[model samples]
Target: QQQVKQSPQSLIVQKGGISIINCAYENTAFDYFPWYQQFPGKGPALLIAIRPDVSEKKEGRFTISFNKSAKQFSLHIMDSQPGDSATYFCAAITSGGSYIPTFGRGTSLIVHP
Candidate 1:
């Protein structure tokens, strides 16, 4: 129970399209669910997150839908754009136990012109 796996080596979304990526985690003890967005060589930034207690959470242009029973989570990007082209990663953390995160390989999203 210590890994988060994501797929889709690359994604192509038209402008204003909705981009979706899925992730599965093994650790049932994970309480904090966070999705990070990284551009090129930069560090990943926390884009959105949800706790196991919640079914789903939404941010401005991003959304995180969590499945407690399935131990899975996904990130949705709305209004895709060329500017939004970046790598996305889904991660999980434990507050009471450890803050260290298990990150998914990453999903590279490309919003076409």
Candidate 2:
């Protein structure tokens, strides 16, 4: 079973707005974070990630922010668009164990243009 919990099962954002998704992991052993975005009829792709050493990581308009002490992390989409609509999953990978990813329930994001 995955130890991560995500919130806001679904989200609706206006075009050019900001879309945010949050997740919390229970295992302190987890050190790697990966955020996946999946489109219909497609597999999830690595969207972005934040390392435990950094509080935040930003790439283009996408950003990943985390609180190592809180064991919480989040994904942020800036200037959201209709094309950005998809199901987002937050995952954590253990540093010493199997190195396998344990995913959260996922959040569905709908961006209206």
Each candidate: what lDDT? 0.89, 0.94
* Per-residue lDDT of model 2, residues 1-113, tens digit only: 56999988999999999999999999999989999999999999999876799999999989999999999999999999999999999999986789999999999999999
**Over the stretch 12-110, how does candidate 1's per-residue lDDT look in tens digits?**
999999999999988888999888899998998988889988888988888888888898899888898899999998888998897998888999999
Question: In the order shown, what is each candidate's alpha-carbon RMSD?
Answer: 1.4, 1.0
Candidate 2: the clashing residue pairs are none
TM-score of each: 0.93, 0.96
Largest TM-score belongs to which candidate?
2
Model 2 residue runs over 4 Å out of place are: none
